[model samples]
Target: MSPRSGPPLDGAIDVHAHYVTPRLRAAMVDAGHAEPDGMPAIPDWSPESALADMDSLGVATALLSVSSPGVHFGSDADARRLARDVNTEGAEIAAARPDRFGLLASLPLPDVTGALAEVEHAFDALGADGITLHTHYDGKHLGHPEHEPLLSALDERAAVVVLHPTSPPCWEAVSAGLPRPLLEFPFETTRAVASLVLSGALERHPRIRFVVPHAGAALPVLADRIAAFSLISGGPPIDVAGALRGLHYDLAGFALPRQLPALLALADPDRLLYGSDLPFTPAPVARGLAEALAADATLTAEQQRSMRRGAAEALFPRFARPGPPGAAEPRPDDRSLRGDQR
Candidate 1:
């Protein structure tokens, strides 16, 4: 199908957009991450550019986050400081245009104490919409025991946690020198989710709503395999499919033609949300993806509308009513689902 030249879906809520503050770019360069996670360079970002991209792509409001190679850069103190700075910047942006933007604050992971402190401030003081967590911090994935405290706190708040994939510690041995995003990122997401399930983090902290990006990122195909392996290994039985269905997923990054179908088989259709991994994904590419999804014939009009906006509205009530100026009214049946924090 030909991609749309104009906006594809009216008032679409983009859940996977990224924002790179100038301070964050500078910090990345200083930390020798000019090309973070083996990517060519840090993408440029600003509130104005973000808004313009949203306008072109039909995004009414974008929940912004700091993408992979998150705030941490080794030093606990420095990571904490950077996390605060970027999160504050993000909050300011969201506050300036609440109708157009929302923030998913970053954290200094691998430093549980610092992360917990920032989480408190980000939610309590900044009124952030949610939090963004990298798949792995240092050498530890999200399921690592050290992160239990942070997970518990998030669960208590029923925080919306978006998982951004980063290069695993073994990237050097496994990545074959190619950029990690090209292949390893999807694998990393799968590994981190598997760890969360196998380690009982998902079961223990059921309220922490995890939004898996890239349409569950290699997970749908591997869900049963992970579950079967857990049993075969003489480990405690893990309901991997249930864990996946309980979590939310964002349709970002090459979701159609294969990934989305696989994800739908394992995930509740209502749990699907729209995501445009902007900035990192160039505007043209992001728009193309959006247009393609909009044009996909397999999804009924209602299903498309749900993925584009309704599902997100169900998750975020703030966007359910009194939408931004000129926004279209949602269909009566669109928001049938409740905002249960599952």
Candidate 2:
């Protein structure tokens, strides 16, 4: 394929981006969770700032999701309310600029009914492109039976579910009290995926198109080991390799030459996507990561292009297309899903 006007992936879609809503950030600070999950402070974010970053980074569209320590904070009612607020605000952003933005609506997970309600409101009312979920809710991993109802609903709809990681209850304490994002988050993602595979969630929810973040977490590097563990543990006769092949993976944090090879071993061109993890990872760092990915000798020009552009285009076709008739300037208040927003 020929190159686009700007960078290598001129119109690439960044699927693993995080959005720090004003309300959520304020709440965190108020609750003395200014360092939520042990991060120094919550990152400041605005739609305008994100759009600018996307332009400079050569990203066409960013599928925004609430990052770690998600919407929930103890009370189920509080979780439901915050989730709705976040999803509504996010929908407003995407509605304002459908071409440049896509909503991966956050759910109040571990509360199946609340999650189901948000799913309906997100897809049916807000016109969200997909839903984002943490690897665990409270302390329950994705594979837990409690999550099956939500998973089943997503499966029935053939939903595009983006699985992000959160440090679960078991990991409250860490070495040197290092930030959860530094080391635990990646492994948490791996732990959740393993739970899904071994618990037969992948097999049962075959149609739920899961987009795994952090280069399939530690899965690519540890897929075989996990499979062996499963066999030795006498888990449900699972097709460990085949199960992994079905999910999509985004290259964000760990796309080094050594890491890319393992991902390539597990997935083909179409299953790869570009992710910035912006704000959390500053634009300069994102640029460096992109540069490194481009310089990786192990990946071919075609495969790199696929990870950068082709795969994302196939996933979000509207962004890949030229601006539709009468595209308007994006505003924080604008809420036009297709024609109008209620």
Candidate 3:
């Protein structure tokens, strides 16, 4: 881990945020019938809007990733094309700003060939920072053998994989009566993590960096239960806690006072990154983060600093440059660094 950069460096890097374009909206509309309720209206997501938010909120830089239903809506060909468009638009934003923006390429899973091909295009050609994958494909859990090749490639390259949640197999119950994102999202994330852990996906792809949203989607609360269930059922004891130690968790939609301490106990504080899940519900996660960081003064100044900024530098590394607070300009080596990591 890098040394803490201290208090003056209030530079925040949100690793779990979303970015969409008109092309993405048109793609979504073209593929799907209607926009679901509670999802934010498609704002004009430009470099200007992101920069303006960074300026207002004291966020220095944000690592941009496509949100769920990411370019994987239609046929493999259509999905691949949409993924390219989304990545190209993101690259354009980074090209113009080079400060406030970076991109995580949205992968078209279930289409393994397309995924591997896009990995090359996005990382080698467009210079995306990382890859964003939904927790599951359609309704299949990530534990399936089909995902191994993709995970293997990512592991070989040491790529950053940001996992977002999608609706589960039981869609009617989740989509109809329950809140689409509020309830189902976290549930799906938890299910995916459990499936991955049980199927030894984490063991196979240890080098791939992961940033799980919604404070790791209730993982902290259910860690013990998972372990107990696995053990009681004569399942292999694979040290789930140790595995999670290497995973990075983001503080998005996590406001409970009790949750932070539990997270601190299980995962390295340096592995926690700030996330706002912007242009979506639960606006301005910083206020909640401030409360959590301020909740425990017993934590050393260095620990607090890591929670605020240092952890992000370690995970993303592109935000380590000198800049004013809330600066939105991309670093000079942004593209190269992203490629190097990939």
Candidate 4:
């Protein structure tokens, strides 16, 4: 296959991408949603706009998920409707750009029945690549009872659950002094991952694949604490770090060019994925991340290929096809399965 412009890497799949459809935008505007003050303005996104950005960034394909603060702001009925609409729209984009796009379906969380219904439609009916979820729903984390049904469904279907962080409950109440994305976003992602790891959620749903963004949040730094908590706290002592290595981590928002050691220390470079939190950060940031991953002396060429492309194939194989024979696979234990997300 021909290499994409600006990079010799083949099959670079952006595992974390957002597509804010017109339907979702209209619902948000009509509801007059009150979001965290420092929450960056939602950019206007459509399939065409997303494709152009990916092409320019040399991204061969992207697994599209809903942007943060998804339909949860609306009433239960409105939330359900918006979820269906956006999911359908996402599928349409994937159909149009078979080689360039795939969808991570959105759902109205905490509404157990609605979430289940959407899952069936998005996964069984629409054929989505996976499911996208916010770290919390109105401050209720993943371990909450309300999420059990959704988790059960994903586990049963072996779905790929892409976890995105949103400002926790009442973030707007104290948004004046803090940078929401800069600090709160990663923290929330970290908090959710830790909760899932410690609360037996990961154990309960071993088949469920989670792709954590922002360089796996602070997970690499806190691996020891999590491991200790697992042992001392009487939670599962089942190798928290190893379990984390089994999970997928995407390199988005890690643009400093100096964060390589921190990322490499947590998991092998192969576990790292290529993601552009586009429309939030510029395309250059994505390119810079690709460059940084290449320059990290700790990562070998084979490992860098996994970070840039192979891991994404593991995360969403329906969308991210593997490269030619004998190419390095992301993980030895990792297996690609046919699954869907609702």
The number of the candidate with the highest TM-score is 1
Q: What lDDT does the true structure give each of the candidates?
A: 0.87, 0.80, 0.72, 0.75
- As a TM-score, model 4 comes out at 0.86
TM-score of 1: 0.93
Model 1 agreement with the true structure over 101-214: per-residue lDDT tens digits: 889999988889999999999999998999999898877889999999999999999999989899989989999999999999999999899989999999999999899999
Ranking by TM-score: 1, 2, 4, 3
Report the C-alpha lDDT of model 3 over 118-146, residue by residue, as the tens digit: 89898889878888888888677777788
Q: Ten consecutive residues with minimal summed lDDT in candidate 3?
A: 1-10
Residue pairs with clashing backbones, model 2: none
Q: lDDT tens digits, residues 142-187, model 2?
A: 9999998999999988888898888767665663578888788888
RMSD of each candidate?
A: 5.4, 4.6, 5.6, 5.7
Best lDDT goes to which candidate?
1
> Which residue pairs in candidate 3 collide?
98-329, 98-330, 99-328, 99-329, 99-330, 100-328, 100-329
Candidate 1 versus truth, CA RMSD in Å, comes to: 5.4
TM for every model, in the order presented, reads 0.93, 0.90, 0.85, 0.86
Off by over 4 Å in 1: 1-3, 322-327, 330-342
How big is the positional error of residue 49 in model 1, measured in Å on the Cα after superposition? 0.6
What's the C-alpha lDDT at position 122 in model 3? 87
- How many clashes (backbone atoms < 3 Å, residues ≥3 apart in a chain or on different chains) does model 4 have? 1
Clashes of each: 0, 0, 7, 1
